[model samples]
Target: MKGAMKALRLHKTTQKIVDGLKLETVPIPEIGPRDVLIDIKATGLCGSDIHFIDGSSILPKFPTILGHETAGIICEVGSEVKDYKVGDRVCANFATPCGKCYQCLTGRPSICPNRSMIGVTDDGAYAEYVKTASSALIRLPDNIPFDQGAAATDAVATPFHMISKRSGMKPGDTVAVFGLGGLGIHAVEIARMYGAGMIIGVDVDDYICERAKKLFGADEVINSRKIDAVAEIKRITGDGVDISLEVVGVPESQLQAVNCLRPGGRALMGGLGAAPVAMPNTGIFVRREWEVLGCYAFENLEIEKVLKLASAGRLDLSKTVTSHIKLEDISVGLQDLHQKKGYPIRIVAVQD
Candidate 1:
């Protein structure tokens, strides 16, 4: 744990992943009193990593590692870390919330202003070893593999939070998920798990739409590019869906998600986009009495719930991972993800 480790470091923001990230031999991270060192076993690539490379998201410092969805084994523990010992299988929540903040006191710690994110604000797990506070660790069940454990940190937990907590999804409610990417596909499955009467998956690509219906739990799929998705959804459901989730950050999809809802319906916004989105007309919005809610990352307890679902065999993630690549091939994987190659749901980096 003391020697040099190979890591993908970002020294500056660039338009391309290859140009921004360099695989270098750097010293392993040192642990503090409340910290522990994890030997990273698997890490999942996310769209936020692309945002970092394209300069859409800026890092506070230069030369930091870039992966946040991670799972690993405890290699070393600090002197003050008594609950966890070496060789414990665990996955970490990227956001470390300060327990005393106003957000934490009110039971909403995911948005803690003083929270520190693992990949965005600090060095993360795109390497062999990562240092994290013990408080951020979640126990990974033995039944779950490292790859799925890594994905559970973000890809699964994010949508689960939006649906279970923010969307106010009741059993038998009709649901529509816009954008069948990693998070969107899981949204379909989670909606079904929550006893949704009908689940529709919307996307611009035909391949993902097909996969959403065939493999995932989507009852119907719509190619938004070919036809009017809102009209088709209205046709499928006589009145419109009771709940709609906009997982695509584009303005068009956001508008469609809102318009596809029934009166007094809820629209949960889970996607992250930089462009400004125009709200619907005031008269229509007021008449419909629609509720629009913004959902951020998951709470720490939500990650545990996702893991429990995965462990119980209720949530099938066997087909979630599209491909597995070595740590050195992460740049190629990122490029394929950015290009939508093979319509990958999730690309993971695995260490031998």
Candidate 2:
């Protein structure tokens, strides 16, 4: 707990991912007065981590650790950290928001203008040890496994926000999820949890669509490559979906998600990419009264609800973890995810 620990790091000196990522031993991070040192039990590989490797604007610093969706056991706590103690099981708020900021004070920490994210702006959980403010730590229940805890941090939390906050999903509402990637798949499951009457999962990949139905309990699956997604969605639902979530950051998919929403229905956009989406027709917003809202991550209180659900056995975060590997294989996992080699929802790295 005092000396160096094994870590997967991306260095500025080696910009290319293949040449840059390395398994190295680094000093275990120390905690400040209000911080807690966590002995990482499991960490998830997310798409945003790739941005760090690709030198995106998200990565605020060079030579930073990358895995952000994580869960661990508290190994050490600072003098001011009274709520948590050593041996406590927990997952952290990946975004470090200034508690005094307007967004934070207004109960919207996810969109805090002055926030620093783990992995992107700070040393993250790719290492055996991580240090975070005690305020960011969310207590984990005894029944939940570390891998599921890690996945729930982002994969589950992101969709929770998309459905609950952005779309105001309600019971009996029909929902459509575009893209069957990790986040999108969870959107399908969480929409179901929201008591959606019908859940549709759309993806170009046949494998993903099948997994969405069999694994995530999607009521219907659409292979967009073979059929007109918007048309199919309209045919399935009498008018259109009550709420549609676009999880694939492509302009076409964004358009499809909005087009499939019924009049007065809302759409949640959680995906991100370089391509810009053209504004929808004026009538769609003006006459139809359709709503499109962008969602970031989950709130701290929202994550607590998810963790509690997982603890009560009401939520199954385990299904989202498709693979479990060691830290040394982080690069291989990242490559597999990048190339879409395996139809993985979430790949987690576990400590041996």
Best by lDDT: 1
Would you give me the overall lDDT of model 2?
0.85
Candidate 1's displacement at residue 23, Å, is: 0.5
Can you tell me which runs of candidate 2 are displaced by over 4 Å?
A: 13-17
TM-score quality measure for candidate 2: 0.95
lDDT of 1 by residue, 1-352 (tens): 5899999998888887667689999999989989999999999999889988888877888888999999999999999999999999999999999999899999998889999988888899889999999999999999999999999999999999999999888899999999999999999999999999999999999889999999987999999999899999999999789999998788999999999999999999998888776479989999999999999999879999999999999998888899999998888889999899888899999997
The models' CA-based lDDT, in order, is 0.92, 0.85
**Minimal lDDT window, size 10, model 1:** 12-21
Deviation of model 1 at 271, angstroms: 0.5
